[model samples]
Target: MRTIRRALDLGCDFFDTAESYGPFVNEELLGRALRGRRDDAVVATKFGWEYEGTARGALNSRPEHIREAVDGSLSRLGTDRIDLLHQHRVDLEVPIEDVAGAVGELIAAGKVLHFGLSEAGASTVRRAHEVCPVSVLQTEYSLWERHLEQEILPVIRDLGIGLVPYSPLGRGFLIHRWVEDS
Candidate 1:
C-alpha cells in the first residue's frame, strides 16, 4: 500500500485493477491508496465474473448486471468516474453488442471515460466496436502467446484501436536470468 501511495504521489497517473482480483479487494485497496488524491490518477478496472459463495465463479454480462457492476466498481474504487472500463472476458451468452451498449451508456453518463475489451475474439471485437468505439483491447500477447498476431491484432490495428498487452513478459517466465539459467 505504501509503495502504491508513493507511486501515486510521484506523478503516477495510471492504475489498473480488476473486479476478479481478490473478488474486488484490489479496487478497494486502490481506493484507499488514492483517497484524497483520486483526481490525480487514472483508474482502469475490469468486470466480468463474481465470486460464487466464496469459492467458485460465474459469468455475468447482462445489461442490468453491467450497470450494477459499474456502480459496484465505482463504490469500491471510491471514484466518480473510471478512466477506462474493460469487460474482463467475453460472455458467450450475451451478445457483444449488448455488452458494448451497456458500457456505452456508462460512457455517455460520464461514469467511464473509455471502453475496452479483454480476451475477445476478432468477430466479437468487431461487433462490440460497432456499438461503441473501443479505445483499447487488452490481451495476453508476447513471443510465446503469438496467437493474437494472426487475427485479433490485425482487426484492432485496422480499426485504429490501441492494444494493451498483458503478461508482456510471459508472466515472469521470460526473465533474462531465467532463460540464462535454464
Candidate 2:
C-alpha cells in the first residue's frame, strides 16, 4: 500500500492489473488503495480466463463470459468503468472478432473507455481492430525479448495503436542481479 501511495505521489497514475493475478487479490488491493482517488488514476485490467471459486481454468473469451468477467472486474476494482480493458490472452477457441465485438459492446455501454490486447499476433490485432479500434497493445517487449519487433510492432504502428510493453525490464531479469547485490 505504501508503494502504491508513493507511486501516486510521484505522479504515477496508470495502473495495470488482471483478474488472473491472484485470481482477484491484486485488483482488490488496487481498488482499496485507489479509494477516493479513482478519478486521478487510469486503471487497466484484463479478463479472459474462466475461474471456479478462485481456481483459474482454461481460456474462455466467449461473449457471455466476457460480460460476466467485466462485471466481476468492475465490482472488484470498485469502479463504474474501466479505463482500459484488455483480453489478457488471445483465446484460440474464441474468434478475435467475437472478442472484439464483445468488448465493443461494453465500450458502447459506457463500461469500458478503451480496448486493448495482450500477447496477440499481427493478424489477430488487425482482425480485432477491424471490429473495434484497439487503443493499445500490451506485449512482453524489452531488449531481452525482441520477438515483437519484427512483426507485431509494424502492424500496431501502422494501425496507430499504442503499445504498452509489459516486462520492460525483462520481467526482472535485468534487476535480478541488482536485487541479489542489495
Candidate 3:
C-alpha cells in the first residue's frame, strides 16, 4: 500500500490491475488506494478471463463477456471510464475480430478510450487493429526479451501503435507510465 501511494505521489497516475489479479482483490485494493483521487488517474485494466471459476477454469474473452468485464472493472476501480483497456491475452475460443468489435463498442459507448493487446502475436495484433485502432501493444520486449523486434515491432511501427515491452524487472503492468529523464 505504501509503495503504491509513493508511486502516485511521484506523479504516477496510470495504474493497471486485472479482475483476474487475486480474482478481484487487486482492483478493490487499488480502489481503496485511490479513494478520492479517481479523476486524477488513468486506470487501465484487462478482460478475457472467467472470473467466476477463476481458480479452476479457462480464459474467457468471448464478446459476450467484454461489457460485463468492463462493468466489473469500473465498479471495482470506482471509475466511469477506462483510459486504456487491454485484452490480457488472445483467446482462441473467440475470434480476434469479435474481441476487437466488443471493445470498439465499448469505445462507442464512452466506456473505454483506447484498446490494447498483451502477449499476442503480430498477425493477431494486425487483425484486431483492423477492427479497432490499437493505441498500444503490451508484449514482453526487453534486454532478455527481443522476440518482438523480429516481427511484432515492424507491424506496430507500420500501424503507428505504441510498443510497451514488459521487462521482468517491470511486468506488463502500466510500465508505459514511467519514462526516464532524457
Candidate 4:
C-alpha cells in the first residue's frame, strides 16, 4: 500500500494489473489503494484465462466470458470503467476476431475505454486490429529481450499501435547486472 501511494505521489498514474495475478486480489488491492484517487490514475487490466475457485485454468476468451470477466474486474477495481483492457494472451481455440469484437462491444458500452493485446504475435495483432483497432500492445521488451525488434515491432509500428513493454528492466536482470558491473 505504501509503495502504491508513493508511486502515485511521484506521478506514476498508469497502473497495469491482470485477473490472473492473484486471480483477483491485486485488482481489489488497487481498488482500495486508489479509493479517492481513481480519477488520477489510468488503470489497465487483462482477461483471457478461466478460473476454477482461484485455480487458473486454460485460456478462455469466449465472448461471453469476456463480458463476465470485465464485470468482475470492474467490481473488484471499484471503478465504473477500465481505462485500457487487454486480452492477457492469445487463445488459439477462439478466433482473434471474436476477441476483438467482444472488446469493441465493451468499448461501445463505455465499460472499457480502449482495447489492448498482450503477448500476441504480428498476425494475430493484425487480424484483431482489423476487427477493432488495438490501442496498445503489451509484451516483454527490454535491452535483454529484443526478439520482437525484427518482426513484431515493425508490424505494430506500421499499424500505429502503441507498445507497452511489460518488463522494460528485463525482470530485474538489468538492475542486477548494473550492480554487479558497478
Candidate 5:
C-alpha cells in the first residue's frame, strides 16, 4: 500500500479494478487509500458477474442491474463519479445496445465519465459503440493472444477507440524464459 501510495503521490493518475477481484475487496482498498485524494486519481472499476459466496459465476447486465451496480461501486470506491466504468464481460442475455444505453445514461448523469467493454467481439463492439461511444476496449492481446488482431483491433482502430490490453505479458508467461528451474 505504501508503494502504491507513493506512486499515486507522484502523479500516477489511473487505476483499474474489477468486481471479480476479491469480489469488491480491491475496490474497498482503493477507496480507503484515496479517501480525501479522490480527485488525484482516475479510478476505473468493472462489473459483470455475481459471486454467490462460492466463486460461482452468473452474468447480470440488466439495465436495473447496471444502475444498481454503479451505485454499489460508487459506495465501495467512495466516489461520486467513476472515471471509467467497464462491463467486465458480455452478457448474452442482454442486448448490446441496451447495455450501452444504460451506460450512456450514467455518463449523462455525470456518474461515469466513459464506458468500456471487456472481451467483447467485433460485431458487439460495433453495436455498442453505435449506441454509446466507447472510449476503450479491454481485452487480452499480445504476441501470444493474437486473436484480437485479426478482427477486434481493426474495428477499434478504425473507430478511434483506444485498446487497453490486459495481460499484455500473457499472465507472466512472457517472462518465463528468465525464470530458472529450482
Candidate 6:
C-alpha cells in the first residue's frame, strides 16, 4: 500500500492492472489504495482471461463476456469508468473484430475511455483497429527485444497508435549499448 502511494506521489499516475493478476486481488488493492484519490491516477486494466476462484484459466472475449467483465472490473476497482481498458491477450477462438466491437460498445457507453491491446500480433492489431481505433499497444519490447520493430512498429506508426514497451530496460536496468530509435 505504501509502495503504491509512494509511486503515485512520484508522478507515476499511470497504473496497469489486470483481472487475471491475482485473479482479482490486484485490482482490489489498487481500488482501496486509490479510494479518495481516484482522479490522481490514470488507471488502465485488462480483461479477457477467465478465472476459477483465484486461478487464471483461459481467454474469453466474446461480446457478452466483455460486457460482464467490465462490470466486475468496475466493482473491483470501485471506479465508475476505467480510464483505459485493454484486451489482455488476443483470444484465438474469437474474431478480432468481435472483440474490438465489444470494447467499442463499452467505449460508447462510457465504461471505457480508450482501448488497447497487449501481447497481440501485428495482424491482429491491424484488424482490431478497423472496428475501434486502437490508442496504444502494450507489448514486450525493449533494447534487447526488437521483434516488435520488424512487424508491429510499422503498422502502429501508420495508424498513429502509441507504443508502450513493457520492459523498456529489458531484463537488466542498464542499457550500455546504443540502440537505434527511428
The TM-score ranking, best first, is 2, 4, 5, 1, 6, 3
Q: Summarize candidate 1's per-residue lDDT along 1-182 as a digit string, tens digits.
A: 79888897787878989878877888999999999989888899988876664443788888898888899899999989999999999999899999999999999999999999999889999999999999899999887789988888899989999988999887788797688998
What are the Cα lDDT values of the candidates? Answer: 0.89, 0.95, 0.85, 0.95, 0.89, 0.89
Give the per-residue lDDT of model 6 (tens digit) for 4-26: 88888999899999888787999
- Write down the lDDT that model 3 would get: 0.85
Best by lDDT: 4
RMSD of 6: 4.4
Worst 10 residues of 2 by lDDT: 1-10
What CA root-mean-square deviation does each model show from the true structure?
2.0, 1.1, 5.4, 1.3, 1.7, 4.4
Candidate achieving higher lDDT, 3 or 6: 6
For model 2, what is the error of residue 58's alpha carbon versus the real structure, in angstroms, after optimal superposition? 0.3
Model 3 residue 67 distance off true place after TM-score fit, in angstroms: 1.2
Q: Write the per-residue lDDT of candidate 2 for residues 94-145, one digit (tens) a residue.
A: 9999999999999999999999999999999999999999999999988899
TM-score, candidate number 3: 0.87
* Model 5 spans > 4 angstroms off: 53-56
Our model 4 lands, by Cα RMSD against the true structure, at 1.3
In model 2, where do residues sit more than 4 Å from their true spots?
Answer: 180-182
Candidate maximizing TM-score: 2
Model 5 has a clash total of 0
- In candidate 4, which residue ranges exceed 4 Å CA deviation? 179-182
The candidate 6 region of ten consecutive residues with least summed lDDT is: 173-182
